[model samples]
Target: MRRVAVIGTGVIGASWAAHFLAHGLDVVASDPAPGAEARLRADVAAIWPTLAPIDGASPDRLTFTADAAEAVADADFVQENGPEREEVKDALFAVLDTAARPEVVLASSSSGLLPSVIARGCPEHPERVVIGHPFNPPHLIPLVEVVPGEKTAEKTVETAMAFYAGVGKRPIRLRQELPGHVANRLQAALWQEAYSLVERGVATVADIDTAITHGPGLRWAVLGPFLTQHLSGGPGGIAHVLEHLGPPTEAWWRDLGQVTLTRELVETLVAGVDEELAGIDRAELVAHRDAVLTALLAAKARTELP
Candidate 1:
């Protein structure tokens, strides 16, 4: 698609706009918030430097509109990144379904809310609505979970997948509609145990963060869990790991901690994070992380890791 509409100019929406513009597509964006246009432009400009060498991005192709309908009108695709409220999304989708062409796929950037509920108000063309959830900092991250609701047409799913792939995103088609999709669920599972550790005084927040960032996180960036486990089987591969270690792994899983975020636990987590980030500036940390991520991605591209 040559042109696209971005509804809601928040961080995710702005990142989507930047990524689309980096691929040389014209972006018509709309956000009602005061100074949203200026912020969106500044965000695009800031991120353009990172994307320019990769895709020759130019900010000249972006247009900001006050009306969401005007933004989506005549657009090839529509990406909605509004707030994560069912009622809000339902109302917004009703308008978008009417404003955009019938064939133009309308995707939501919802992190977890199901497309089925979000598009419930779109009686005329609920089939065109689907979830196109992207990881944070979409300009750098490659993952985009393309999930279709029950009413979403098969052709619409195919179109959404193809469009995301065409724009250099790694899109995965989920077979079932589950809350939090795949990655977020996996992250939540890990965090559940991580919080348990902190709650039980097994590890301080800094210690846990360091353990992941310096240990598993490094390998995870290159290979996922199953592959890493397969490789860990010495010459036996996953079959052997499953055969010999499966029972022990199951035992460990059974013994894993479960936690609920009570008030005390919440305070503990907040204080731990505060102590960990005592002197660090949030913006500087983000910049450092993004720089490292950019370099890591470039290095990974030169290797055969898949």
Candidate 2:
């Protein structure tokens, strides 16, 4: 798409606008919140340097409006990142539906909400409503889950996939709708165990962080869990690895804990993180993370990993 309408200038929306601009698309973003335009511009400016914008790509191409309808007036595609509540989504999509062209695809950056609920806002052409969920900062992360609702047209899916891929994103299409999609669900599985560990006093928060960052996290950065496990099997591959490790793995699964984040647990988790980050400046930590992530992405780009 030559022009993308970002219908919320929050973190995710701003990041998506920056990403689209870096890929040479014109971006028009809208958010009703006070100072949203200025904040969006600043956010885009901060993220621009990391993008290495392509030819014809420039922050100058970004535009802002307080009205979502105005933002999508001439956009070829729309990426919605408004509030996550179902009512808000339905109402917002209704506005987008009325303002945007009939054929233009409207994509939501919702992490867990169903596209069907999002489509409910669009009476004219609910088929154009789809989910284009992205992880945290879209400017850096590549994963975009392109999910279609019950009424979403096959053509809309194809267009969303193509548009996302064209902008240098790694887009995956879900065969059916599911809460939290796939990646987030995978993350939740690990998070659940991590929280359980903390609640049970099995490991300190800092130690748990170390266990992942120095161990499996390092491997996971290069490949997903399945591929990493395949390598763990050596020449025997995943099948052989499963044969040898399946029993213990199943037992461990059976032992895995289920947890509820009660008030006490929340406080404990927050306190643990505070302790872990003691003496570390939050800004510096984020900068270091961004720098390292950029390098990692570059390294992966030069490799043949999937």
Candidate 3:
């Protein structure tokens, strides 16, 4: 079995550690925070059952240390989930670079930090550094963005991709790096429009959410926007859909409201959310969402959706 070193045993790190363990990979986790090991172990134990364990998986496969270098000393792969600060990351990677083997893939879980900037601290083997950004709560989310830096080696990217796939993640390779990567950019566009509509008195927060949840969101879960459009066009496919809807879509885009979040707007948005979620326990809502998401994922795995 492979060994994965998880530096920074916080939410993302703990999730990654649990995931590695679930796949029967021994995980050595490190974090400097007081009681970090306890918290990480507890979190992993809690999340372990939800993951469909295979390959002789068990939470007992995990070990922890306060020393980051010690964790990576004999690890097959190193996943850095330290604080999302460049200086902190640079300093941490410098320590990691000196400890880990030259060929071991050093991957980051950074949401937006560029891998090139991150590779600055590892002059010895900058080519081995790459981004393996997973969606939040890594174990539950299937998408892992395997992004490479300017100096990231092709071998490193290939290794990271294979490792993530081995752990049951759906890894997508980015041809070029971009701010917020791909999925976040798509979500940001939808969020901007949602915010604009609320600001322009077009819809309540609940109604806007309903519009997506009861409508396009269902289709989106099955396939991406382009493919959904193709299916919607029947025999015409995407080309026909574009020929028919392209002009009107462009018109809607031209009219989308641009919003700047002022203090008042922030308050309005918060209040809107509060009202929408009134009388609903946040924990229960999260539980329901996760339960449904898990079912959806299981169902998707049985298909050739893409």
**Pairs in clash, predicted candidate 3:** none
Q: What is the lDDT of residue 301 in candidate 1?
A: 81
Per-residue lDDT tens digits of candidate 2, residues 1-306? 688999998889988999999999999999999999999999999889888889989999998899889999899999999998999998898899999999999999999998988899999999999999998779988899999999999999999999889888899999989999999999899999999999999998999999999999999988889999999999998998899999999999999999999999999999999999998987788778889888998999999545
Residue pairs in clash, model 2 = none
Q: Rank the candidates by lDDT, best first.
A: 2, 1, 3
The window of 10 residues in a row where model 2 has the poorest summed lDDT is: 281-290
lDDT score for residue 209 of model 3: 93
Q: Give lDDT tens digits, candidate 1, residues 80-195.
A: 99999998898888889899999999999999999899879788899999999999899899999999999999999999999999998899999999999899999999999999
Local error of candidate 1 at 246, Å?
A: 1.1
The candidate that achieves the highest lDDT relative to the unseen native structure: 2
Candidate 1 minimal-lDDT segment of 10 residues: 49-58
Off by over 4 Å in 2: none
Report how far off residue 141 is in candidate 2 (Å). Answer: 0.7
What is each predicted model's overall lDDT from 0 to 1? Answer: 0.92, 0.92, 0.91
RMSD of 1: 1.3
Residue-level lDDT for 105 in candidate 3: 90
Give the per-residue lDDT digits (tens) of candidate 3, residues 102-207: 9999999998888999999998999999999998779898899989999999999999999999999999999999878888889889999999999989999899
The number of the candidate with the highest TM-score is 2
